[model samples]
Target: MRVMEAALVMMSGEAVVVEAPSVAAGFEALYEAEYAAMVRLARGLVDTTEQAEEIVQDAYTKVFDRWNSLKEPGGYLRTAVVNGSRSELRKREVRRRIGLDRPLDSGPDERDHMVDALAKLSPNRKTALVLRFYADLPEKEIAELMGVRPGTVKSTISRALAELRKEIDR
Candidate 1:
């Protein structure tokens, strides 16, 4: 009976000692695996690579905090990075609207203008565009992430592209 009790204790102790991966370790793996791709994705959504880097880092921090709850961590992180870049762009637009800041550049080919045009769009449209173009996600994936129908994603992308065309023509 004593030997049986000792065996149970040893088994339970070993079970308790088996640890899951740490959040930091998970985040590091995610960062290493996706950082460059995220930066490139963000660069298309933001004005500069520096801003893109900052946005990606902010997204990673958020992912770190919510790692355990994430089902598809990579997809979540990508969406978070896109959302973070969009948020930064929105802040810049607000500043521009309030006369708190000047347009960063006037170059026609510069991404700043493209980002500015995107900022003028509705959040849903902007999100759709980012997910479809920058993230290279399919319409179904964009709809899934945006919590909308695939038809809505299609319409949003159409409108966003029209807006971009008008901006480019200016």
Candidate 2:
């Protein structure tokens, strides 16, 4: 059984075979492989599971919209998720500043010190830490995703780790 059809064309005298995966088929495979991981990535960067799911869904919609044009769909999807998470955090901050945000009353059983410390971090620091630790991304890749220099990513991660240590110590 052929998964994709190969076409042969003659450039000079020798024939060249070219095979292309169907857009829908490729996208389905990508979604199946990356959906869970993408959601996890988003969850690390966002406040709630619901927001993570929404961010991932929106990223998938964006990836599917430009699937054929993307050179690297996975990278595009990652960038989209990071951007979406950043936007969500900014909106949340705006609401908090405007007194439109409500506080969560977590029981002692649900309160996680590390999570609380992470939430207290600035968005850039939080993003740098999440991408470095949770995603296990290299400084270069994290820099690319965060649109910063590798040196900046290095310093950000260092400072974030120090801050996390201080926060958790308290």
Q: Compute the lDDT for candidate 2.
A: 0.85
- Provide the lowest-lDDT 10-residue window in model 1: 1-10
Candidate 2 weakest ten by summed lDDT: 1-10
- List the candidate 1 regions with Cα displacement exceeding 4 Å: 1-25, 106-127
TM-score of each: 0.71, 0.82
Give the alpha-carbon lDDT of every model: 0.75, 0.85
Candidate 2 residue pairs that clash: none
lDDT of 1 by residue, 126-160 (tens): 77787787678999988877677999889889988
**How well is each residue in 123-170 modelled by candidate 2, as lDDT tens digits?**
889999999888999999999999999999999999999999999998
List candidate 2 segments past 4 Å from native: 1-21, 103-109
* Candidate maximizing lDDT: 2
